[model samples]
Target: MTTNTRAWRWGQLLALTLGALSSLHCVELPTKSYSCSSAEDCQGLSGPGGVSYVCGSGGWCEAPAGSACPQASTPPTCSTSNWCWDNPLSEGRNLITVRGRSATDIWAVGERGIALHWDGTCWARILPGNSQQLRAAWPAAGQTWWFAGAGGSLLTWDGANWTSQALAEQVTFHDIEGASGTSAIAVGQAGALYTFNGQQWRPQSWDAGTSPAPDLLAVWPVSNTEAWAVGRNGTVVRGVDGGWSRVSNPTSVDLVAIAPGADAGTAYAVGRGVLATYANSTWTASSFATSTTPLNGVWTSAGVTRIVGPASNIFVLGSATPEPSGTSQVLNSIWGNDTSLWAVGGSGSIVRRAGGQWSEFPGGVARTINAIWGTDDRNLWAVGDQDLIMRRVDERWSPAAPPEPGAFRALWGSGDTLLAAENNPTATGGSNGKIHLFQNGQWTPSASFPSNGVNAFWGTGLAPVWAVGTGGLIRRRDEAGTWLTEGNPNTASAQFNAVWGVPNAEVWAVGAGGAIFRRDVSGSWVSQRPSGATELFGVWGTGSRDVWAVGLNGSAWRYDGTTWTQVSTGVTQTLRAIAGRSTDSVWAVGDNGTITYWNGSTWMPQVSGVSENLRAVWVTQTSVWVAGANGTVLRLPL
Candidate 1:
């Protein structure tokens, strides 16, 4: 690899689009300008992805190190803020449940006390400082809101402060709802049911003579006296006048969420492979032909029914039109009436539907980054979760058009041909494995893969890439563009995480149980375990005789063409990915922001400045990039 001659600047990394990131009203940027007369005029100015601006000679705020650049060889001194965020424009936190009075006033809550408020125009992040995984929220219009979650966490937001109330510490509330500040209801595990009536909290008996009281998962409140709760084994109950009675359900699958329909006596409920409708006090059920993933939320208004579930899937009844949700993450909860709709899901995904179409809110592409790859400083690819293929071309990051619906795991490019391993969860039972090819700006599905999910890709920068994934399945794509399985075609009980090739030599794959497998000349697999670690996440090598592997608990090992020996790295954080520029320089990154380097001698630790787990790392001549959870990317100039 050759070093990039152009001077790279921090000004380009500062092009952060601050759409809905900060919770503090002060740090939140206002409507800004795009032109500038001097560098001082561009100060404190930024765009999407939080990328800051610099004054160019054209009297406009320009990115990418400004118009007049410095020589890459003559770099400036490093700043304290080395690692920074580059995508989603904010700290992307998973939002599980959303509630409020209307579109203008909204509260979307997630685990670990993460919440956000939408005031029609802007979204502000709110971290309540509670580490417990929150499961439910009842945003009661005004300042007063209710929250309950794991460990029986029950707290109230009274505009100015959050107040916790005593409750069973072992029970986890899964869902909560309230009519106003005075009335609300929450249902949870182990048939857990609680009621709030403005003054004191009370535990209500919800069995009404059912066995073990099926763990209630969802609750809907019509009035203080009338409420409905649903749970496992298709259990549904109606409470009136302080008495709970069991109701008939059409399916045995667990009902996760329910919503009243447009009609007075109509309702819609969805869950695992089950969709049911209730009208005139009778229940009927069916399943989606195109989806088997559990449906999480349902909404109905003005005779229109909409359902949201895994894979950012959204569809409306009557029309049954599959709307592009702009995300591939699973949607956990959806809200709104007919014209305006909001669906929040995994990894900070927020999408809205209006004017008979769906548009994104810019938080979905930052889902857990699994892998990062690029051939040059001008081109890089990051792929993960629900069809996310973000490309950084010419120093700008944008998403490529997604291929067939699936969760992308690994990405590699050879010349103009880009290959991505996609876990197609649209299948019935589990994910079906497939490889997608990106050429000429479009993604096309390749032949079917043997495993259920592909994890990593490694090979020469040419045809015949080696792919390894779940089920201990190994496959290779030859020059003819045909995928041929190399290992046992039916042996699928184990999972492989990473793979590497030795040019014209053997291929190596590492996975759980410290499994190190090498393909011989005859294509036979030989397993070796020099370091009896529990799990190995990544593997790479400099040559046929010189190879390295990193895995659980900071485990590292090197092969001398004969055997593997364990090497100590001095840290216990699990290393996920390993990449090297040569035998003299290598980098490994993993959990808790751990970044270690091998200087052809001893292993040394480097400061990452963030605690978010780093999953993927890429080494180039000028810079090293690390990607991980919460849309974090740290850059260290080499």
Candidate 2:
């Protein structure tokens, strides 16, 4: 036999004995040089399993069908940030229940009647019927689903259409389940229980005429003769051998939700961080140490427990398995001083950053604080719903007495004096537009606005504050207690929303439809024409020689004392507010969490990494602060 053939036979025998060897193993090899321009030209290089070699250009052996090989000297490549996945936006607060067949196929509903689906990778938000929270979901045959929630809300999804159904009683429907297409039960607040028999939903006959309101939270069905319902004040009702009986819970706190765990016969109920296991006709309570921080949701899947709270706090409980972690800043409102910083948002979230590290502050209020402002590092104020006004007196924040129950739109402060403009809730048959001033340790109501609603306000000091609102209302205070109307800016159909002032003489008012009015040294307002008709919302100036204005539809303009010139912002998002430490160092913020910088001649976009609507920007020599809806606040290094 030839030497090559003998070597091939021995190699084949070796490979056969080593069963671990894969089919790609070669039996024989002979070295020979071949020339080729393309893959098809390398004929003799084919191996037994279609493995072949090709030669091209510089004549190096390579895989028959592949791109050029990498250089041997090339180093490995990597990226800095993960840049792969980010936190999912919270569609609603107070998620009461979540259920899914798989990791990606899940549904969650909560306060504001919000419903969303998790399709394994990301969440796709769905519009549930009402703004009231949906508490439970029951999936039936043929893609039919039923949802129950606040105020007796019942909706059915038949794979295509979602229609609301009226219940017989006016109560909050909390839990629902079914054993078959014709047999279903629903229970809710006020000891309400309903039964459905294929054709219609009707009240279930019960003899507990003197039973207190149940406030039911969940329901489960084991079979035609066995079911359970759990609810408030630690109440549980069980169906035993075709009969119903009441049971007592160890804890008096409300049992918010319940579900069967790994063993279908075993069930669990969760309430106030306490979990109870029910199995084999007995119940045992266990304590789950959740954060002192207020929690909004608790969800379980595949033996894992996930909890979410304010400030983007998502925690996975259960012996530390691999899960998503970290606090993503869902900033709502932000304020900064020369030495300290603060921000607040959803779920009474409060964060403070000092010397470059952020920590959660425990003394935050419960409402969503919408506006934040301060005179200095020692004192600050945040305002929001439920008549909220929190004050930072020294290093800690305490809830202050809120002003009248109205939505606070704009806040401006100088020294210890402050002025807040509220959107008139009475105008459209709501509250009348009014201004509240904080001076001498008291919040006093001031002159009412001429227009129906206030939009924005800006000023240098306490007395000469300027506030603008709807219907082109301009209220000015010049060292006087009264707010008087200045000359109506002749922008025809535009409604002014913002006013910026270097002083009484050099004030600029901006609003919708690209209207900008400049007040010269005589307090006379003159309209500045822009190249395009886009609404302007914010204006800032380093001096009288240079000023910049930013607004909707990606509009930004600069005025150099003589003429106004359009500047390219490199973005189409609406710009809402502007602040600058110098003419060449200006920052503008707006809708979609946009931040644009002016570097002497060109405007460039910076990565703010947020999607909330930024309404205001404030800058100092060392830092910049941006504030927006959802209590979003972001600060970047100067």
Candidate 3:
């Protein structure tokens, strides 16, 4: 598609400096369990928020407590100051571009201003204090690396300190390349072209002769004096002798990426089914693919050409033998020399091409998490879309061993007994609602129940389990271990989202259209209405007397064993789930990364470093855990 600039960012440079490390108090970290004989084995080890680690006396890795880890220098505009993504080690965010000077020293940047680096050991994430989409990078051997992204972000990192320059324009820079540390060219939306010559940045004008100029997506610098940038609708421009101008038309398939060939004046540009090359001072375009398979990136080194795109498609120019990509994930960018190569793309996918084989490195799950529960930090479980179930054992997160796939929307467990509630909202007639029971090391579907979807679960310990679901379906398991249907409290057509209570004594389920149902002492389901609230999605409490329910439009309600009353939650974002460690340590999370804390009296907001809709929250005595869209899990110290 032809490009027109949409949402833009104009940012002021906010610089932060890192201090040298010194003797620090050690904090025993959870087990990554990489056995080390010396300190070097733990060098590249990092945890959430890039928490630094060191080789401990036990021949294991541990974190240096209170050490300075790079975080946002700006004070959180919300309630609390510390919130970090805790799931999918390495990095869970999608990687857009990859570049490096060597196999070990590599940089991959992607959505949400996330940068990952490989230091001859393991991948470590670096947060540059910005959350905008980053899609451009430039790497020069033995020199500082350059990264440009959305919000006019331009920054440089020297493996130690960071320096940033605030570009005045409100545009996203898609690609940046330079000949030396001093000279570089960047291009982005609306045909933006900027040149940096060591001292400062100066805008270079280029005309597309259209109302909205095409986006300049990729840039390749052959030398300090020559470069090329390509983008939508055959947008190709060249820089030579300190001037920039439009290039001759070739293909109009929206060239996304361009790469230099084996020699000067030789390059390749690729897009949907089209591959265009430049040589002998002329541009040639041809059908590179039999079908319209979009090629996202192209690279060439010492006569080897590799093109990559969606579904693990890797093609070499003039060769029919396809590269053996071990992963089926889309590849966004490729860079390397003759000896080694690397490609990164969607869903934190990174694959290495070395020893004539391609292998994907282990990364985190990228699905939307629906619920999070656990006994402590060392043992936690999270379930999300597509039957994704991840477990944290000894503080290290990994997918549970074939936990039998199921869409679990609510999870509750204690000690060895855990239950996962299936999120089925489309029950037609029979007892189609389902649940999963965990045993040995895997999860299996339970027998049967009413409704098609079970949205929530609650119980005393494990024996008497209570569940609620779509069509206001409710069920109970008695001492005889038999699951039986319960009354729907006159709201059988509305879907229930959450359930919590004492097994047989009391239970509460809340869901669609502000519907709230409670099972009283006499074991009869009754409406908790006059609820005066919006669609409620979650219900929780400290005990039988005090309870809380949260839902759409930031609605919050409290029950003191008698009636449910509404409370004002300053913000208006939809709240999906709520949890608390006690009366004063309650947290509710919802859409747009919303996090609010209830410190006994008033509810306040906290900043989560993500934009995916937050759906679940779990609070421990010392920390708060929240899970949501895109396998997002955030942790903040209490």
TM-score of each: 0.59, 0.48, 0.68
lDDT of 1 by residue, 1-638 (tens): 21221222222221232222231011222334434567887787654435566766545554556312111111211325354444442244567787766667776777556666666644555445677767787876457778877878687776556788868536888999875668888888888888888776788885546666778888888777787788887888888977887888678888999988778877788887788788777878888644467688887766877788867458777765677775667788888865678878776667677655554454334456788876444446687765565655223344443565457788776654677888765345555778887554445677566436788887765456788887766878888787777776433555789988776678889898888888776777787767466689988878877788899999998888998989898779999998887887888899998988888998887777667788998866667888887555666766
Q: Sort by lDDT, best first: what order?
A: 3, 1, 2
Better of 2 and 3 by lDDT: 3
Between prediction 1 and prediction 3, the one with superior lDDT is 3
Comparing 1 and 2 by TM-score, which wins?
1
Best by TM-score: 3
The positional error of residue 149 in candidate 3, measured at the CA in angstroms, is 5.5
Residue lDDT tens for model 3, 1-638: 00111111100000010110000101112323334567786776654335656755544444454332333122222224588657544345778898886666778889877787766544556667678888887764356788888888688888776678788897999888777768888899898899888767788987777868899998888888888889988888888887778887698888999998777778999988899899998888889876478799899876888998866458989888777554446778888888678888776667666656665543335566788876445445687765555665224344442234356677766434456766544444533556776543334566455445777777766557787777667777665656787875386776888888753467788988888888887878888865467799988887778889999999999999898889887768999998887788788899998888888899988777667799988776567888887666778876
Collision count for each candidate, in order:
13, 15, 3
Q: Any runs in candidate 1 off by more than 4 Å, and if so which?
A: 1-95, 116-125, 158-160, 168-170, 287-292, 301-303, 337-340, 354-361, 366-586, 589-596, 604-615, 618-624, 628-638
What's model 1's lDDT at 546? 76
lDDT of each: 0.69, 0.57, 0.70
Ranking by TM-score: 3, 1, 2
TM-score, structure 3 vs. true = 0.68
